[model samples]
Target chain A: MTFVLGIDGGGTSCRAALATADGAILGRAKAGAANIRSDLTGARTNIVEAARQAFLAAGEDPDLIPQTPAVLGLAGANVGTYKQQLEAILPFSRSSVETDAEIALEGAVGSGDGAMAILGTGTAYMVRKNGKSRPIGGWGFQVGDQGSGARIGRDLLEQTLLAYDGVREPSPLTAEMMGVFRNNPQDVVEFTTNAKPGDFGGFAPKVFDYAAKGDAVATWIVDKAVADVEASLGVLGLEAGDPLCLLGGLAPLYAPRLSERHRALLKTPLDDALGGAVRMAVRMFAAPVEAAR
Target chain B: MTFVLGIDGGGTSCRAALATADGAILGRAKAGAANIRSDLTGARTNIVEAARQAFLAAGEDPDLIPQTPAVLGLAGANVGTYKQQLEAILPFSRSSVETDAEIALEGAVGSGDGAMAILGTGTAYMVRKNGKSRPIGGWGFQVGDQGSGARIGRDLLEQTLLAYDGVREPSPLTAEMMGVFRNNPQDVVEFTTNAKPGDFGGFAPKVFDYAAKGDAVATWIVDKAVADVEASLGVLGLEAGDPLCLLGGLAPLYAPRLSERHRALLKTPLDDALGGAVRMAVRMFAAPVEAAR
Candidate 1:
């Protein structure tokens, strides 16, 4: 009669699911973003709220929450203190916290060896081989996240300013971006002075959209971003026969542009990170005989 | 017997000079940094303090401050509001605030038609011709500041991270920078997360130093930075026989590295920004006979 809860927490949103030990999902719920770096208190609150909503959808009494075991995959969990802090506040009788990348890898390969890359507002890659997993990139938008949407948006902004100064040739994409800032370099300066990664990431789709129309600057940015991704994928040592799944919002947009070698290796993930979290819980709470298998 | 005050306010420090109508310096004093964009209140206080100390050193009464006409060349004075706000709080009988680049150009060219480039922690160029001055760069460190020491430092940090990620070959300069960050990419990430242009600029000398010793990455960074400076200079339209002076902390460091064409046009400045401020005050307060010259 025991159930397990799974959570996928990210900078943009948090999702939760409830499932039986056998891995049949009974209910699912979602809440606002839960980025531990910027909003630890908010993330903690959203994480609890998402779990509660999932339990309610499953027709479970609120008092039964602490009796259920849970596993969570959260953005910013690589920072050990954040994971420890989030774990301390969980209401479940037993809970474990891991990085969103870890859960995505689990969900993509289903306990098998493979590689997965997430390309959302942020970018990260994980390669699972045998029983060990190695992560590359995703050091956050400031220092890493090389091929991330945020990086592309930031590059576009920089290029627009360069065009304004006549350092680089201005194209339609640069012109359109300048118009957004009222064609004032000072306004662009002020905008970047206080901008966060997600704020910059907000401009990525426009870049991609423009690139599709063959705007030179936009095309250059997209090409560089894709090259960075390909370089990282190469660094991950993705083999010809290895299964590779692209995850996150930008994945579909970028898929067609990947090189043929990568295209042949690409596979759809078996499940999402929430399902991966649930799978983790299933492994943790399964009977000894089942866990051994 | 009336005198003038000239104030030079920069991101690193503030300096003020007391000078006669004939431009003979009676006294000079310096105080802490004064950046209006980041700390307007601090800048205001430093500006006043520098002026007061200059008067005190010149054996003049502090009460004479309000009676003294002054011209202030300050960083971040390009924005009209900053000038307006600083003007409202000035103790001088008549005070005008202009960008540091403007005053530097005045000091360098001495009422003549010419151009001057300030290559300090930031980069900006000003050209004065036929009693009109136009500024070309100096769009702050975030979007512009292309040939700047801050940009070079930021680029070095980025390359160091790339080396850490194995995306780029590790060079001695990268190794030394990584050592400074405890050889941890995460530590470097933390360092850059909140770093300001000045914080980054602090590393520029080390880059130059290493480049002098032929470190590959350091040499590449300096070459690119110098090239950018050359490009900006080209855009500024430096004709032969035009007097050009390079100003700022890094100016001397970069002067010899500039192409021979630029070196031939480079001339020693008549004075510094402080002297230019005094000249401005003289222009505003000089007797008709002296003003005519």
Candidate 2:
């Protein structure tokens, strides 16, 4: 009868779920971006809104929601200051705030002794060992998030512009990009300017699609992306035989491009970050009531 | 005395000069971009303004100026359709309009017959022989301006974003870009969105500057640009023993990086595009007045 709530707050969107102690999903909800670095109040509201939806979907009353413990995997929560800020907003008597990277790692490898590389709106490589998480990269969309969907998207846009500038020979990929942007170079500028990390990241699939059609530039971009991911795995001290997990919308697209050494290390997760959050919540609440608080 | 006017109109700026039939410069003027494809009225006004200034600088009143023949080396004027559009607005009674690529070639070789590569706002390779111009590549900024300043700038920006997204390891080059953009990821978007071909081309110098400091990403960019330029030279049928002129702002930066074979072909221009334009104007006016018109 024990209920626990798990939340994964990302840059573009947030997901929350109500689950049983055994990882059975009872209900779930999704909301807008809740990254504290960009929006603090929005982050709080998104978490609360997602939680309320999950509880309501589970046919539970609002007053009864406080009985369950919660765990939040949030972007920007790794900063100590942000962790304190989040703790002030959530109602969980037993709750833990950690980076989305850490939560993704726990979700991908239930045992918490492995590593996970996330290739979503941005990219992050995280390892959890000895009850601590170490991250190699995840600086954001400005300084060091390589091998991520956003990186791939940015590359695609750049090559397209290079082709437009006649600095790169034209390939079918250039034509496709030009067509997508209606052949107006200004549109490429406009779309990229207004794009969020996730919005640009979304173009990763299109890059793959073009590559499949024999676009050399597109293929080059994909191959480069694979190399970037492989390099990240190497930085994590991951050997050829070590266990690793790939997560995010881009993982599947890049899966076919990984090296055999890295491919052998890949493992499909039994649960996602929300499930990991639920497990964390259950463990937190199992403590004595005084210790839990 | 016969007077000749030579004009070089590019994406960011225009240069015009009045010269004697013997290639002696009398005066010169600078104005903003006069690429007709990007700006029609602006292009005409810029040329007229620059010509007027040059005439005044040479101690001639605007109305007293002779109806000198002119040669315009302009970006975007190579496209046959665009050339016609430009011809309609320019004031020259008789003029020859050619791609900046051709002008760069004429500039590099002077009155000699040879080949030249330009890595300016855009990149192109052209060969001049028997008074006719043959171009190897000048496909515009979107399809094949390899080794150009614009390509290098685009690469630098893409690498910066990749580093910021945690998809790649941070390099000193990426760090430099972050610092230049004020450490704001959003500023990257803003700067790139508003970027003109020349703006991206402008970053070529920064890439070289960073490469000199041993930044891996900058070095990679420079290496790639050199490769691309060499490839363009190869396509132009440039032999080691043949004369090849290197013109454009980026040419000097790339000189130290070229292969001996390329270095052997490289020659400093005795006269730039402006001088070549003057030469062309003089030649045109030397013909029968009816033929000149």
Give the candidate number with the greatest DockQ.
Answer: 1
**Tens digit of per-residue lDDT, candidate 1, span A1-293:** 37888899987899999998788999999999989888888998898889889989988865778898888998778764988887888788888998888887888878778999999888988998776888888767766787798888888888898788777799998998889998878888888888888888899988999999999999999999999899888877777688999998799889999999999999999998899999878876765537566
Question: Highest TM-score: which candidate?
Answer: 1
Residue pair clashes in candidate 1: none
Measured against the true two-chain complex, the DockQ scores of the candidates, in the order shown, are: 0.55, 0.14
Model 1 score (lDDT): 0.86
Interface RMSD of 1: 1.8
Q: What is the TM-score of chain B alone in each candidate?
A: 0.87, 0.78
TM-score of 2: 0.74
In order, what lDDT does every prediction score?
0.86, 0.76
Question: On residues B54-145, what C-alpha lDDT tens digit does candidate 2 reach at each position?
Answer: 88888876553446667888976755377777777677666677777767667778655788877677776777666676776554454346
Tens digits of per-residue lDDT for model 1, B1-293 = 37889899987899999988777889999999989888888898998999899989999886888888888998778874999988888888888888887788888888778899888888988887777888877777766888798888888887888777776788999998889988877787788888888888899999999999999899999999999889888776778999999987788889999999999999999987788888777776765638565
Mark the regions of model 2 whose C-alpha exceeds 4 Å error after superposition: A1-4, A19-24, A63-70, A76-97, A119-123, A137-225, A239-242, A253-261, A284-293, B21-23, B64-68, B119-124, B129-225, B285-293
